[model samples]
Target: MSFIRPEVRAMFLRWREALVGAAILLLGLYWSFGVTPGLLSWVGYLALIIGAILLFAGVQRGRARMGGGGPGVVQIVERRIGYFGPLNGGLVDLEAVTSISLDPTEHPRHWIITHEGGPALHVPINAEGADVLFDAFSSLPGLSPGRVASTLKHEGTAPIVLWRRPDLEKRIARLH
Candidate 1:
């Protein structure tokens, strides 16, 4: 029997990375300012930097995560993202993606990933394995993780374009 309630456990699981990062940050603080000396102090400084980065990334991932169990399953393989949902689903290649947008007008927000020569794939934010999209989206060229996280957390009714391929932007500008 577990003492922790299921809801509490699930919450912890969702923020596990941030929790770990916080712990590391604490350890680094203690080592840097507490009783550690010389080389250990320097190491502690390094740890501080690493901890801060991890914490930032963790917070971003945590914000992006929508607790799953919404609808559909998301899979990313070989840089391709595939969404399998009851009503709608599609596959999007990360490399060929031209734009990524968030449609907050939906019941549960949906990520509209548009790729070259294909229909846009609409993946629900809370879909199972959707958290993995954080890493996948981060790997896209010139995409900013901070911007993505901020956009994901924004409470807006209109659709927001999160990222666009730089080359595509230049091409469209040239044509206009």
Candidate 2:
């Protein structure tokens, strides 16, 4: 038995980033006034910057969930991600993934996981258990967690490539 409903759980995941930012901002205020005052009051600015970044992340996350959810539930276990969507879905190995892209212009937004010699798998951002992906993708080298959340609100019609295998990037560079 679980204390939190799945829907509520998902909702929390969706807004968690923003909530974190708010907390940081509050801490900054306390640091400025309570912990360090006068000359060190400027320290609060650090919190403000961090809070803004976190708040932005939260906004983008909320944007991704604008449509409630599409036709899928994602599962991540032992470095493998499985997506079950209505029309199409499949599993992909985290290590074998070539790149992860965010297609924000889509109806509900999607995370396109790509692999060499295989068609990409599309996972809706608002799908149940989609929150697991944040941790999974965070493990990748040279990938920024803030950037991952920020790209959820990318302002473009085309898909935004969030991260690519170093080898893939080199290969693309060679092709050019």
Q: CA lDDT, every prediction?
A: 0.88, 0.81
The TM-score, computed over Cα atoms with residue i paired to residue i, of candidate 2 is 0.66
Q: For candidate 2, lDDT tens digit of each residue in 1-176?
A: 99999989877766888889989888777877777466556778788789888887776555445334557888998999999988899999899999999887887788999986679999888787787787788789999767876777577889999999998899999999
- Give one digit per residue, the lDDT tens place, for model 1 in 123-149: 989999998998998998888777778
Give per-model CA RMSD. 1.6, 5.5
User: Clashing pairs in model 1?
Assistant: none
Worst 10 residues of 2 by lDDT: 61-70
Q: How far out, in Å, is residue 70 in model 1?
A: 0.8
Displacement of residue 75 (Cα, Å) in model 2 is 0.4
**Ten consecutive residues with minimal summed lDDT in candidate 1?**
35-44
